[model samples]
Target: DAGITQSPRHKVTETGTPVTLRCHQTENHRYMYWYRQDPGHGLRLIHYSYGVKDTDKGEVSDGYSVSRSKTEDFLLTLESATSSQTSVYFCAISEGLAGGTQYFGPGTRLLVL
Candidate 1:
């Protein structure tokens, strides 16, 4: 995905600890999203933003939270890291319409030990 960067903010964290990952896009797309990938499960949506400060939880949003104070940044935070949350995280960007093409950033692997 162009103009997208998924930060591996933390490679490892202890269980019960809080973890925060970041995704940044320079394409000025109006829609940003977060997804997690596991072995058996495909990429599952976590949260998404349609604009600055306009965000909604996705399928796997129970133990996670998101904040998009700026259009260029989308922050995903795990309230408390757990082994179950260990997986590769991705950030995607979409053009004007969310139904349009989407550009995905590099996956950031987060390991909760």
Candidate 2:
């Protein structure tokens, strides 16, 4: 990755193992999204939640699950992650709708070996 984030920002994990990444925001934005950025794919949405406990699957939702038990926190879990799932994951928060301006957090680079 770009090496802009902190220590846990760059993670190296193995395949078939469960991985959970958290995005916590103190702003309490209404819309939160989890997106993965790859070389060719650019950024693909994995999941997004509008409110606490109200979530919707995105285009690349397969093999991924999300939970939003609180408005300030969003969790993205990969059940038995595979090599194909290795990418830079990002969490974005927006006050308006989906197309509105979004503030993105530092990416978490996950390398599944």
Candidate 3:
């Protein structure tokens, strides 16, 4: 309800390819985060941006990268797709993490074979 969306709700691809996921928001929140969901890890942070052009890597940023050039848009890119990278990706936005409130996008399901 706040304002968030993710592109390519479902995708299937061979390994070693490149993939890019897009996240958009209309609420203009100050913080945006990218996360990957796996069976054991639950949701692990991949990257986050606190402001336009101000971004940082997170725990699961090894095979991923993110950029936030505008207040309403954030993009996540996978340099090279891998079977291990097959997972559900979620985009979230919040005023800040301290408040324990975040709006999540529908999510992208990517598969590599």
Candidate 4:
């Protein structure tokens, strides 16, 4: 009954290093999203994909990138790890953009030291 799942639930890295997180969904939704959660900023979108290989950047996508090769798999990569990038990353899935209900994964906790 799992709808979505994220790999490497917990990660610890150093500054200037590269990091990648994986999100997998069994719901077969058309839309996938990557978001980061911080104490003050709340949940911010990093990137999202409308369809396979069709992705776009979000408001806070400066240092993050995303790729969706298949309908059920989405990957988020941080070009270089930074202390400011340390947060809980979440993956969401939706059926459509207009009024779709997004389902979130458990979340990946990343620490950049």
Candidate 1: lDDT of 12?
89
My TM-score estimates for the predictions, one after another, are 0.95, 0.92, 0.94, 0.95
Cα displacement (angstroms), candidate 1, residue 61, comes to 0.7
Score each candidate by Cα lDDT.
Answer: 0.91, 0.87, 0.91, 0.92
TM-score of 1: 0.95
Report the C-alpha lDDT of model 1 over 17-99, residue by residue, as the tens digit: 99889999999899999999999899999999999999998889999999999999999999899999999999999987866
Ranking by lDDT: 4, 3, 1, 2
Model 3 error, position 68 (Å)? 0.9
Model 4: lowest-lDDT 10 consecutive positions = 94-103
Error of 4 at 91 (Å): 0.4
How would the candidate models be sorted by TM-score, starting from the highest? 4, 1, 3, 2
lDDT of 4 by residue, 23-108 (tens): 99998899999999999899999899999999988879999988888999999999999999999999999887823588899999
RMSD of 4: 1.2
In the range 54-73, model 3's lDDT, one tens digit per residue, is 99988889989888889999
Q: Positional deviation of 91 in candidate 1, in angstroms?
A: 0.4
